[model samples]
Target: MRKSAALALAACVAVPAFARTDVGVSIGINEPGAYGRIDIGNFQPEVVYAQPVIIERSRYYENRTPVYLYVPVEQQQHWRRYCHVYRACGEPVYFVQEQWVEQRWREEHPGWRRHHRGWDRWDHDRGEHRGYGY
Candidate 1:
């Protein structure tokens, strides 16, 4: 009975260790579903709000130029809660409209899907040299 109880306890602890799983995906600038700073350059981007949103006011940010960001609508509405994610809690930020981001991505990456077809297969193979290697 003592051996059976100990084996059961060990199995309960070991099972969770083998069952744990973690997955992460990184989205970079100009990609769909990306959320971070965007370089507007000389051209002006359409923004969701006319004025820049300032979550925190401090003397340090007074002379700094405002940054443009492409964030989810929910994050924009709750800037105070999500500002730290972009590391712009105190800096002035202009949230670009989602429509503009989609348009710009389409214009800039017209052949992105076709060009990256083989790359996608290569990534799926986890760097194994298959015939689909780019």
Candidate 2:
């Protein structure tokens, strides 16, 4: 009976390790008091990180949502200008880097290379449709 109990305990521990899901979000730093900054983009945008960028994730509906930390003041101003020009504010935005998107895309769509340039196909198509009433 002791052997059976031990076996069951071992299985309980081992199963969860393999049953975990990958939500496609990761943190590069583990600093205390790190907080997610407000993001204003369709997807994660490419930027030069002068400081360590922190992202937070929460389970939303059936998918996980990521929030990106704010960039430096200068970078924020530049991005704000672009947002105003493109009318991309007041939309649901998640902070993600370009590389992270590419990696996730490659995993989902195997055999397809990352050829969409900086923005993904959705952003590209959105830009095209923005000229119309969208």
How accurate locally, in lDDT, is each candidate?
0.80, 0.45
Pick by lDDT: which candidate is best? Answer: 1
Tens-digit lDDT track for model 1 on 1-134? 99999999999999988963432322235675777898765556889889889987888776889888999999999999999999998889999888888777877778665255555664685766778756
Weakest ten-residue segment in model 1 by summed lDDT? 20-29
List per-candidate RMSD values in Å: 18.9, 13.5
Per-residue lDDT of 8 in model 1 = 98
Question: Cα miss at 126, model 1 (Å)?
Answer: 21
Q: For candidate 2, write residues 9-93 as lDDT tens digits.
A: 9999999888646444443422212323433344444544543222222244235243354333444446544434333343333
Which pairs in model 1 have colliding backbones?
A: none
Tell me the TM-score of model 1. 0.60
